[model samples]
Target: KREGDKWILNGQKKWIGNATFADILIIWARNEADNEVKGFIVKKDNPGFAVEKMKDKMALRIVQNGIITLTNCEVEEADRLQNANSFKDTAKVLQMTRAGVAWQAVGCARGAYENALDYTRTRKQFGKPIASFQLIQNHLVEMLSNLTAMQTLCFRLSQLQDQGLLKDEHASLAKVFCSLRTRDVVSKAREVMGGNGILLEYNVARFVADAEAIYSYEGTKEINTLIVGRAITGFSAFV
Candidate 1:
């Protein structure tokens, strides 16, 4: 709501990463008058902005996620994001972030693969290291294959983004594929770790849990799939 020279904002955003200590926050709200979503820059010192730190997340524990409440948050007209006039502008940011998430997934899977490989190489069984076993080698190869595929997809996605040809569907497809595949890669990493897989000392255990969080965030597998589906099929799967 607009009030003289300032806009009043009231709403809540939850599971927001970096909201707890962010110096500045970029918020998107629908202007009741125009019915178009607009962006606002809210400083952390604003009296109307309050945040509570979320606790005990299974993954992404390093990030401080918060729930933010804006109680009649007041913003100067000049604080509005000049380049972002509507929701479509907000979506452009998501497209880039989704691509970045795809790359993150690849990195996560690669770490799991490397850690699992090193563990197997020194983990002795039946008078030889487990890596000498045919089945263990097979698992290692499969993990590498999935990791390679994720890398290739994200590489092209980055190229498209650099070329300014990136589209929402392109980023969505990469996110959907890489996040889903990372889950598989991490699972295999744990599998090769034997009973030690679940142990925190092995490092693969964290990746296993982290994969679940990555699978859901930025967009879920089903939602990203629908984004690509709608683009190629010329229909809205969203109701």
Candidate 2:
């Protein structure tokens, strides 16, 4: 709602990371009058803004996620993001960040692979190092293949970004592929570690859990797939 030069925001947000301590927030809301999505910069101390931390998280527990409530949150016109007039403008930011999330998937998989490889080499069974076993080597190879493929693909993604040719579909496709591969790679990493894999002391456990978060954030596999599907087919499936 608009009151002269101010906007009154009322809403609730969930699964908001870092909101508990964030000094400022970039809020996206739809203009009731124009029905166009707009962005606002709200300070943490705003009278109508409140945040409550969420607990019992399964993944990405290190980061504080919060629930935000806005009750007649008053924001000045000067605080509105002049560049963000519509969802399309907001999408420009997501497209770039989605590419970065693809990179994050790669890193997560790499960490798990490296840790698994080290454990296999040191862990012994049947009077020999497990790394010497054929099955273990096969799992390692599969993980390596996925990791390499994801890395090379993202390398091209970065190049496209640098050339200013990055598109939403490109980022979505990369995010889908990399995040899926990361899940596989991390699972294999945990498998090779045996029972120790689930133990936080091994670190692969954390990677396994964190991969789940990565798989869903920045867009889910299904949503990103639709973005790519629409791009290739010239059909927008989004309703």
Candidate 3:
């Protein structure tokens, strides 16, 4: 039921980052009249609003993700976003978030590559630094190549977005490619560290685990691939 100019919200949202600490929440609900999704800005400490912190994440433990529940949560009509009318409008928000995730993948990969390279330089084996060895050098070169390529791809992706020429497929392609490459770069980083790689204090292990999460978020590799596939083939392969 509506009260004056306010509407009621009742539902749950999962895997929301910072939900446990955010002062304001953007709640998406379907309008009963037209069945279109609408966005609402609900303030913290509102009646009937509750949030539970998500726990035991193997990766990205630093991020405070949570599950939010709203029970007859009151939100002013003025709090509703004026432009978001449906899920299609929601897509605009997701598109930007997806691009950010892609760039994050690049950053993660670059960090792993740099750390591993530095460790190999100082880490000695057989009385000499491992970075001097051919095998070790090869791994470093390959890691740099993939990291550089991902950086360039994300740079172009951002440029396209700035130019207003970016499309869903374009962002999807970068997300898919960069995320997969990040996984590879992290793996190489871990491999170069040998047994020390698995140790959390070494940092490579954290990157490895975090890369797994990055690989799956924004959109999984398979999902993003299909998005690009559908665009290129002119056929909707998504079932």
Candidate 4:
């Protein structure tokens, strides 16, 4: 039931990207009337809404993330999303975003690989370019191997999406696999950079930390693994 023709929203959302500048935010909240999850298009200038920019981010400095709070925020019934009746609808949104995150992992690894390769070519050690070192070449090869595998896997993943054959388990499998391998590639890229690896100016450090966030967000490794496990075993392991 609408309270005097205005719906009141009260909740907190963390790590909301572009919340400060977004003109319309698709907010997912629990409906007070039916206890089901609902979606709302809340404008940035809504009176009862407040946003705080999240600070102290070591990675993904380019992404504008915020902490949003809704306190009796009023919205018209017409603004509510009609299709979102439960968490299943929310899962639909996350499934799409999770696939995008997998692609992002690929791009991020590619960027780090390119940067580290350039650095190794230019940075000299022991009267020779660091790229000529056998250990450095080995690291580069390993990174390339992981990157190539992740790329091929995500390519098939998108093909599945285009064919409408993607399932939760498929997305979870891709997310888990790509995120895990991206972490490995970024780590190796950093390792090959010597002391400059951790510096943000070197750029690999950002990928390294951002990979951690990508790994955990949307779904953690444990959660994604369980989703795939449940699909294969036909038993829900998530308690």
Candidate 5:
């Protein structure tokens, strides 16, 4: 809605990160006239803007998520991102951020795998270190393999991004593959840690929860898979 020379925003945004303390917020809203999405930077002290912190998150607790509400929040046209015109612009941002999510998956998987590996070396079962057992060794090797593959894939994805050769499908493929593999790796980590796996003191349990969050963040596994599938077959599988 327009008020004199400024636009008034009314809506709510969920899962906003660092919202309470953010000096500036990049708010995206749909334009009523054309139904095109537009981006605006709202100052922290805007009276019409309010934020409520989201609580009881299982992972990424250090980052504060919030629910932002705007009731007739006035914004100057100058605060708008001039280049951002439509949902495609918003998608450009998501595509870039999705690559970071893929990297996050790899890091989570690697950390869990490493921590579990160390625990196995010191953890004894039946009077022998669990790492010496054939079954436990298999889990370790599998986790390491998945972790290694994700690392190499992310490295190449970064290179493609740096070279301006990265496409939406490329990032989507990486996001789906890495996040799915990370889930497997974290599960194996918890499995190898046995009874201690669920304990927060053991460290693997935190990764287990965080891995689950990563798996569904940016885009769910099914969503990203459809994106890659569409690119490969020229068929839009998203319904």
Candidate 6:
């Protein structure tokens, strides 16, 4: 929205997954009068809005994403999300999604480890299966260690969530920790596969690329760390 209590939305949102087919989308916009963030439910048939499908994504290719444009989009005051008064309420949604992202990381890492392990069992080096080698075994063990730790931590995180004690800082911490460790595990999994590591047919390569998206999305490590830092230090580091 612009000035003078008039609504005039003109912007584009990229990588908006499912926007092309979504019946209703919650669009976040700044109020013209107060410049405050507000949300409106935009229906699929809205004339002023258009969504273009984003194509040729290397990672997370199965997830259909779209670039949305809102041109002179109009919504009544009653259509605005009343509860989303500020960025704080928006954070509540992110906190919940962050926890889910942590679980997704675990799944991604576990899939890579399993695939790499299966490959190692049949891949031979020095006249012996690669899985029998001390170096390969060490790598597998390290991957398992990190994966186990992430699983346990996320289990505890879900407990906090179930108990209604989950906070933004807590979710951010899990998101940061799991995503970072998942990156390490997936990279090692790819490394152990030798030249086949980079091949999408081997499967570990996809996990490696997907990990990059998971690490940056929801919240980057720096942002999540600052969230936890502010919780403990009582100082807002976010500018």
Off by over 4 Å in 5: none
**lDDT by residue (tens digit), candidate 5, 16-56:** 88997899999999888888899999998886999999999
Q: Write the per-residue lDDT of candidate 2 for residues 35-137, one digit (tens) a residue.
A: 9999999999987999999999888888999999999999999999999999999989889989999999999999999999999999999899999999999
* Candidate 1, position 154, lDDT: 92
Clashing pairs in 2: none
Q: What lDDT does each candidate get?
A: 0.93, 0.95, 0.90, 0.89, 0.91, 0.89
Off by over 4 Å in 4: none
TM-score of 1: 0.97
Error of 5 at 228 (Å): 1.4
* Residue 45 of model 5, lDDT score: 86
Residue 227 lDDT in candidate 4: 86
**Which ten residues in a row are the worst by lDDT in model 1?**
82-91
Residue pairs clashing in model 4 are none
Which numbered prediction scores highest in TM-score against the true structure? Answer: 2
In model 1, which runs have C-alpha deviations exceeding 4 angstroms? none
RMSD of each: 1.0, 0.9, 1.6, 1.5, 1.1, 1.9
Clashing residue pairs in all predictions, respectively, total: 0, 0, 0, 0, 0, 0
Ten consecutive residues with minimal summed lDDT in candidate 5? 1-10
In order of appearance, the predictions have TM-scores of: 0.97, 0.98, 0.94, 0.94, 0.97, 0.94
